[model samples]
Target: MALVNDRFSKWATGFSGCDGGDIGSPHSKSIWYCGIEWGGGHPDDEHELINKVLSNDVEFPSEGYTSDDSPPGWLYNLAYRFNWQAMKLLTAVSGDSITSYKVFAEKVKPFTKGEKGYFKMNLYPLAFVNTSHDLWKNGFAKATGLDTKKDYHDWIKANRFPIMKTWMDTYSPKLIICVGKSYLPEFSLAFFGEELTFESEIIDDRELSWAVNKNGTIMVVLPFLGNRNGLNKNVSIQKFGDRIRELLTTL
Candidate 1:
């Protein structure tokens, strides 16, 4: 069965506030737990927005827009065209929260090389990877104790990989960048057929590491760009984004 939702979510323009396990909900139980949350937005200007993201300049909204006057295609612009820089740069990510997706993209924006764009990375279809959507939602628990590291690892492979495999197969991105190095083993095992090795390198005086899947998709390990922290502690995430951009330039 097709695991990713081809339909643009009902909240395509913004976050859907529905809680889990509801009937006829935009976020169906299946999607709440497993569907690829990115893509399928069916943006109003797919080609135009994509071209901007690819060749011209694309910028994230300084903050969420509340005015009804906000352009309808902004969602397509922010979320897909430019907002999620990591995913845009590498084309695949395993994130659960919409906030985190937006944060990382924003954080990386300032660090981006120029007003024009961030990285010269290839794009791919089918880009979200929640690992387990049920894990991050508040006040929610799972059949497995998703909070535990061991249990989390178990859940991702047993429940999430099949869905991810379907997505990876469908899109076949040239790279799959993971937030936090913790998942490299599982990620490598799932998509690359074995435990791929990584090499650490210094870029712009900062250090980072990455791996490559046998399928030719480069796998990068980065800090979680949530509200808290990212690749560097002493530096702001904006700077961290710049550092990583320099590192990726080498890759």
Candidate 2:
């Protein structure tokens, strides 16, 4: 089957928090990584992340992760995974270059905890959304605890799209970048209220396509953002930054 047909096991999303001097630019200091639901959707009790609203002393999964009951294939690194490449893209556009993810994480610490920004890109709440495909996989390690949260799941079914729209509208970042493009159609449905008809344009290494909604939020779909402990080699952060900026200029 095609990559699009495969179910993604990774799912994460966030909004940055830093006053963007250049607010109008697509390369604005803010960027978003639409999470991954790794592990072929094993132990996938994914929720809308009400945990964020409940108590957020630390980020998600980092707080919820417990390996004792987790499935055999469960990769521990999935917890608290940040998109360093996404951060690099932010640094590239902002001119406030960061050398590593460690540096970027440190800088965003205050803001992630809800430090007010005068013109901040606000990365707090680290909003996460599980693709509908995150579930529906045939596997031995099916999800648990889903029975108790039918109401929450109901809310997710009804409000997930609107809530996502709210997040997008509130941040209003020039560019809305997603980690993987396999599920691009689902993303289009969420943002634009219909499936997108798209044609890819090859930009040196990767083929990219753009979908601009009525408000002009350019959704740039690409592969997994960067290395997860030296895996997911298909994603080249350096190449992405180079080609993305160039592509943005053409339109």
Candidate 3:
């Protein structure tokens, strides 16, 4: 069965915070992982506070209130989860360059409790969308105990992969930057076949980057960035943007 966009929508709805009542029906073109739900608030409840945060209109403390009435620790938890997912993608795309997990964390933290919450929300969704195929073929469900019925892989393959693939095939971007190392091998195997060359240069005990190109063609596996050394700390957002531009130039 071919994947379609709607099926991916359904799969995304299966997550802990994706209940439809508060979020309403997601649009086919709406940012799938951009984090802005229709009704606002956490996935479970609709609160004015949540709406404000989602809209990027949140203020540190409401007008007269001394402290926020928002759920205690929920904001932090949400931020942490979002960062984790982004890290996953970053590692997959960048490999050893991801040494500064803290860098990624700090970069994403400011967006957590603001109108850009959707940005934080979509990090995982985008990662899932980009890597869903590799994950399923590689037995990620079995290893992680993620229910095939509800997880992104099952849902995307059933619904969205075709659309995404069409987009990628058309664009054929040269560098696919993933944020976490954990996702690299699986992604490589799924997209480029199992026999492809993987030349690894280890950065530390926990992470390394393997460089490979598809059939001596345009596509190349750049280094996977991980959270390790102060790389994240040292690299500025402008520098990251420059890196992305540099990668695009190769394509």
Candidate with the greatest TM-score versus the true structure = 2
* Higher-TM-score candidate of 1 and 2: 2
What is candidate 3's lDDT per residue for 1-251, written digit by digit as tens? 32333322443333322211111112211111222122222232223212422233221211111114242222332244443444434432343254554565445332233322222221123223223334333233332334443464455443333433333243333343333444454445433444355544423233333344442222223232223432243243224434444443454
Q: Give the TM-score of candidate 2.
A: 0.50
Off by over 4 Å in 1: 1-153, 204-207, 226-229, 232-251
The TM-score measured for candidate 1 stands at 0.40
Put down candidate 1 lDDT per residue, 1-251, tens digits, no spaces: 22312122111111221111111111211111111233332222434323332232222211222223233222322543333343332222222233354554444331132221211211111122333433332111121123333443454455445444544454454444454455556655654556768876653354455675554455555544332433433233344445444444555
Q: How far is candidate 3 from the true structure (C-alpha RMSD, Å)?
A: 12.6
For lDDT, candidate 1 versus 2, the one ahead is 2
Error of 2 at 103 (Å): 4.4
Give the per-residue Cα lDDT of candidate 1 at 172.
50
Candidate 3 residue 114 Cα shift, in angstroms, is: 22
Rank the candidate models, highest TM-score first.
2, 1, 3
Local distance difference test scores for all models:
0.35, 0.41, 0.33
Q: Per-candidate RMSD vs. true structure?
A: 14.7, 10.6, 12.6
